[model samples]
Target: MTRIIQLSDPHIVPEGTLCYGVVDTGKALQQAVATINRNLPLWGKVDMVIVTGDITDFGTAEEYARFRSIMADLALPVRVVPGNHDLRENMRTAFQDQDWMPESGGINWSAEFSDFGLICLDTLVEGHHHGELQPDALAFLSDTLKNLGSKPVVVGMHHPPFNTGIIPMDINNLRDSAELSKIIESHPAEVRLVCGHVHRSVTRSFGKAIGLIAPGTSHTVTIDQRVENPHTLSLEPGAFMMHEWRDDGIVSHIIAGNYSDERHPFTTPV
Candidate 1:
């Protein structure tokens, strides 16, 4: 079994800074790390931790520095992809030593594990919140999938390929989604697409694969579907995901951040 933890959209800032003069993104992320470490003993061996995107609120060098400091505690192999809120150059600079990362272009790359191959595609469109699948990104994905053959694969990105019903977010969702769907549909293997830009948990069917949207670690977006107003962020319980690949198939679980009064012994029912 290959166990993977998915932490996304922490939007971490410098140690003393607050995001938007409201959310203490740095503290939120710190709490999240504590939460994960607390639960690690229960989950057993976690192969790696994948940060889907939006790692920093401003995508600044200082923020990335803080990000590095916090993630270093995990002491596990860490893989990341850029989100709309991220700057490609700085992100590459922050993790340049990772031999798997591409030196140029969209930052698309792949990694191999005991039970699955991870194919991470870059959907970051630089100056926009919306994501794009340019020619180069698509080509890289197609080639990676073809090379991986029939192995169970998890395609990680920063944007969901389908609209999530949140009007403001949908406006900035992945563009040319059909083209991406076509590529995944043609693949001859069980593929699961996991991403994090939505800030809320959602599941959608993407052609022949399952697409999962992981919750943000800092905050969650309100799930309002009406198109008459701007979307809002909420202080709801932040969360992450755990993707467990067993011999049968892949099972993804949503893990709420911060553990306190929720703990209880698993005593069998009388």
Candidate 2:
């Protein structure tokens, strides 16, 4: 069985600084890393760790360095895509050594496993909060999916193609996704779309495929559904996702960043 860990929206800031003058994102990510490493024995072998996006809060060199420093302790291989908060050039320079980092153009790539394939696309539009897939990226997705040939696959991106009733975030969703939807609908096998940006776990149907949005590693976008409510962030417990390839299909589990106590077994009548 192949398993992949998804860590999203860490939003790392420079040392000694707190994100939005509240959440200690650095510490939050540390806890998340410790949590995953501590629980690895229970999950067995994890193939790779994928950080969907929003790695840094300000997309600075210092932030990227800090992000890497925190992630260094992870025991599994790592792959990443850029989010709105990420500066593509800075991210490219930071992960240039990694094979998945593209030397030029968008930070798009793919990985193939025996059971399924993983394709990560770049949806970052610099100097803007909203996301879009340019012509080149669309071409890449088209070619990659064509080559994968009808096996179950997970398409990872920074922006979700569907809305989650959060008006603030819904407005920034992947715009002009009609072509993207058409592409996925044409796939012969199951196609799962996994994304991050909203800082909350949301599931929705995107065309013929399932769309999943992961929670943040530090904070969450407040879940008020009222259209008039202003956008806000909450100090919610951090979490990550575990995507495993099961015999039937891929199963995703959300794991919290920390626990208050040790596990307890159920009591039985004597």
Best by TM-score: 2
**lDDT (C-alpha, whole model) for all candidates:** 0.87, 0.92
Query: Per-prediction TM-score, please?
Result: 0.95, 0.98
**Position 125, candidate 1: lDDT:** 88
Q: Put down candidate 2 lDDT per residue, 143-253, tens digits, no spaces.
A: 899999978899999999888899999999899999999989888999889999999899988988889999999999999999796999999899989998888798999
For candidate 1, list the clashing residue pairs, or say none. none
* TM-score (C-alpha) between model 2 and the true structure: 0.98
lDDT of 2: 0.92
- Tens digits of per-residue lDDT for model 1, 1-270: 898889999998878777767788877777877888888888889888899999998899988889989888776788899999899999999988888667888888888777888888889988899999889989988998888888888999998988888989988988888888998988887899999898999999989999999999878888989878477888887889999887768889998877683676889878
For lDDT, the strongest prediction is 2
RMSD of each: 1.8, 1.1
